[model samples]
Target: MAWYHSYFKGLPQVAWKLHQDEEYTDFEVDFLRDVLELKKGNQVLDILSGYGRHALPLAEAGCKMTCIDISAEYCDELSNAKTKRKLPVEVLCGDVLETDFGQGKFDAAYCLGNSLSFFPRADMLRFFTKIAGSVKPGGHVALHTENLAESILPNFQARNWMPVGDDIYYLAENEYRPEEGCIEAQQTFISGSEKVTHTVYQYIYTLAEISAMLESVGLKVVGTFGNLEADPFVLGDEQLYLVAVRK
Candidate 1:
């Protein structure tokens, strides 16, 4: 099984819940709204929509939302929330690569929270092709990631430890393979007396490579930003937020 198939459950989920910040989500949603030129009745797709952080807010604002995620646990939570709120949101739980997003179905789509780095070259190309095909001509797609080659390589750390929430302590030991253009990481989460470890991989791509891939899929690169505030993307900016329009 892929590392992500099991990595996002249990303790990692708990850590993610604690890491949630409403302010940050609002900022990102605002950025998405502006970049995508979203309207109240527009249909939007949230790829790998973990727990509906951005999906929920966008749905509340009256956009129709279709969220696809791999984690059943997160999907259940999002479904229950949607039920309670009576939002126009549809939740689909499965591997994104295998799921059909449908052609020309959405006005806009987004893959956020560094989820774009999960796939290697070939799979990444397939994923972008799916996104390109899913949106209508002139529709927009937004991608967010912190694993860009320029950003990560300049600040590469072999090992790092940080606190997650109040009780969980997290550590990551990373090994960068230049030949494969990926980072293999062993991540450990410790809370109270319980501890768990998982291995994850994030494929790195240069900005030029990413632009080329999107172009190859018939998506033209439109805007690139370093943050939600619309700052220009600079080398070592730590985040890449790219917007593209389908041709």
Candidate 2:
């Protein structure tokens, strides 16, 4: 099984919850709304939508949301939240690569939270093609990642440690392989008496490569930003947020 198949369970999930900031989510959602020109009742797809952070809010705002996630734990949480809030959210648990996203079904689609790095070159192309075919003509697609080659290379760190919450401590040891154009990370999560370690892999793509791949899938690049505020992207900006339109 892939490392990502089991990476989101246990302490990692707790760490993610603790690390998330509501204010940041608000900023990101607003950016997405503007970039996608989303309106009430528009159908939206949230790729790898972990726990529906963006989906729930968009659904509450009157947009129809379809969220696909690989983790059943996250899908359950999202489903419970949808039930409690009575939101227009449909949560599907499965590998996004294999999931059938019908053609021309959605008005807009987004993959955020740095999830684009999960796939290698071929899989990335496949995912982009799926997304392009899933959205209507003139529809928009948005993506976010911090693993771009220009962003990570200049400031790469071999190891780092940080605290996620009062109880959870996290450490990451990263190894960059130029040949593979990927980062292999061994992450350790600790919370009180419990501890776990997992190996994570993220592919590194340059901006040119990513834009070309999106274009190859009939998604034309429109905007590239460094943050939710819509600043123009530059090298070593720590994040890449892209907006594309389906041709």
Candidate 3:
């Protein structure tokens, strides 16, 4: 595995430390249900459901969820949470690229938290095709991610820091490669006197590029939002919340 591939594999505490905002989680889950039209007992697929942040809440909302993640620790956390809460949640530990849930298997599906960009650009189409094959005809799919346009902005900040907790901070530096259509980032976690840094790469796709890719895989673009509350998508928005339906 590459140095960045398993960067988040086993550290649930660290993951939570970086993304512990309950309001953000609730907003995402709300958008998933509202936009996807998911209801109680509906079958949903959550790709890269790290630590069940979204899956557990979706299960709580009465959805039968199948969550897949490469992180064994995250899957274990999900399994334990499901068992403890008696929620209809199935945790699958495997690579998203290799997993096959069969065609027309789900009513709704989602890949949130910028997970879609983790794969190389060469595999982008295959990834979307796989997702299209997993959902039933007319089923909805939602993807929340950082807008690629942001990377190309004239005033894009290459480095930034986010305070995580008392005496702890998360630092990030982004380097965009226009020729390769990807971003290589160096991320550092500083907690009191301890600090760790990791480098990772992610492909950046424009809204048009992503829409075309999804369409090529039989997923018709239905809606685009700038936020979780369903605001219309516009240029300069840092995030993109795209909703599509299987044809």
TM-score ranking, best first? 1, 2, 3
* Candidate 1 total steric clashes: 0
lDDT of 2 at 235: 90
Using lDDT as the measure, the top candidate is: 1
lDDT (10s digit) by residue, model 2, range 1-247: 6678888888998898788899999988998889999999999999999999999999999999999999888999999999999999999898888998688999999999888889989999999999999999999999999899989999999999999989999999999999999999999999888999999999999999999999998999999999888899999899999999999
TM-score of each: 0.98, 0.98, 0.92
Better of 2 and 3 by lDDT: 2
Colliding residue pairs in candidate 3: none
Residue pairs with backbone atoms closer than 3 Å in model 2 (clashes):
none
What residue runs in model 1 are displaced by over 4 Å at the alpha carbon? none
lDDT of 3 by residue, 1-247 (tens): 6443467742324745366687888878888888899999999999888888889999998999999988777788789999999999988888877887767899999998777677776678888989999999989999988746653464567998877656667788999888987778898877767777778787888889889999999999999888876888887887889999999
Full-model lDDT, candidate 1: 0.94
Q: What lDDT would candidate 2 get against the real structure?
A: 0.93
Candidate 1 local lDDT, 1-247, one digit each (tens): 6678887899998898788788888999999999999999999999999999999999999999999999999999999999999999999999998998788999999999888889999999999999999999999999999999989999899999989888999999999999999999999999999999999999999999999999999999999999888898999899999999999
